[model samples]
Target: MNAENPQSPPVASVPLYQLKAEFFKTLGHPVRIRVLELLSTRDHAVAEMLPEVGVEPANLSQQLAVLRRAKLVHARREGSTVVYTLASAEVADLLRVARSIIGSLITDQAGLLADLRAADRG
Candidate 1:
């Protein structure tokens, strides 16, 4: 426990179950995913995102609060409004990877459907 003991390994802290739960809970909403996607493009105020995402002001605020708490997004006051942006470029990269996987899955499913249709017609 002594900081001066260079030979000692750092204490292993208990896993943060509550923090993990909150992070997943925050990401559980579709609106939050859309918000993250928009932020990945560029920083924007809640007002700007509202019109783009078609969510009401109150709903947007709620979603942003969840993202902010998870540290997935960061906010700063810009005059009258708070501009929100992804906490890091890695967050955008993660979204891109997720989208790629989803696209591949959808394409595979479509191909299967097409094959089934062709067989049925034959």
Candidate 2:
């Protein structure tokens, strides 16, 4: 039931998979991923991240805003600086898993490349 219009039909709910995809889409940016990786270790003030992220201040701010909107990170103001922290410990776990997956893929590719080179010589 719509609060504004009692007779109006309820809005369609987003599918769980669709929501998941949207969440991943939010993490697709390199800057956002770096930000998350940084927060994974410990909370950091915006100034602390600027040098590590190596992006213009405005660009980093935009990435932080995206992470904030996705609920992957939380921000708080401390005097003159805004500090950020991961919303859940699971986010750090997720990054570790992703790193492992990518590492495995790279290792597999390297093995295949070595096999191909050996075959060429043989």
Candidate 3:
């Protein structure tokens, strides 16, 4: 243990649920979620993202700051352009899983509603 950073071990000792909750909290915003979804495909410049995301530059910048603090996106400077990309492939995997789960949920709800309607008519 380095005398300079004793807090590092405590961070590792924190419960997994707390870490997960904190991570989810970071993803609670729609803009942050959209930024992550776009970056999952490829690196994008701030200018390129603005139109696609349909947000003002200041709003997008706020979302990017949250993602950066969460360590979910990496930013690079190319001349005057600020390019953003996912920090890891796992973020993309998480997004894909979320889509699948929501899809399945909608399917289940439709099935339940159909059964209810059929029962009501019988």
Instruction: Name the best candidate (by TM-score).
Output: 2
How much lDDT does each candidate structure score?
0.87, 0.95, 0.93
Each candidate's clash count: 0, 0, 0
Displacement of residue 28 (Cα, Å) in model 2 is: 0.4
Q: After aligning candidate 2 to the native by TM-score, how far in Å is the CA of 92 from where it should be?
A: 0.6
Error of 3 at 30 (Å): 0.8
Name the runs in model 3 displaced over 4 angstroms. 1-12
Best by the lDDT measure: 2
lDDT of 3 by residue, 1-122 (tens): 54669755533468989989999999998899999999989999999899989999999999999999889999999998899999999999999999999999999999999999999999
lDDT of 1: 0.87
- Candidate 3: which pairs clash? none
Model 3 lowest lDDT segment of ten? 2-11
Is 1 or 3 the stronger prediction by TM-score? 3
Tell me the TM-score of each prediction against the true structure. 0.79, 0.91, 0.90
Worst 10 residues of 1 by lDDT: 1-10
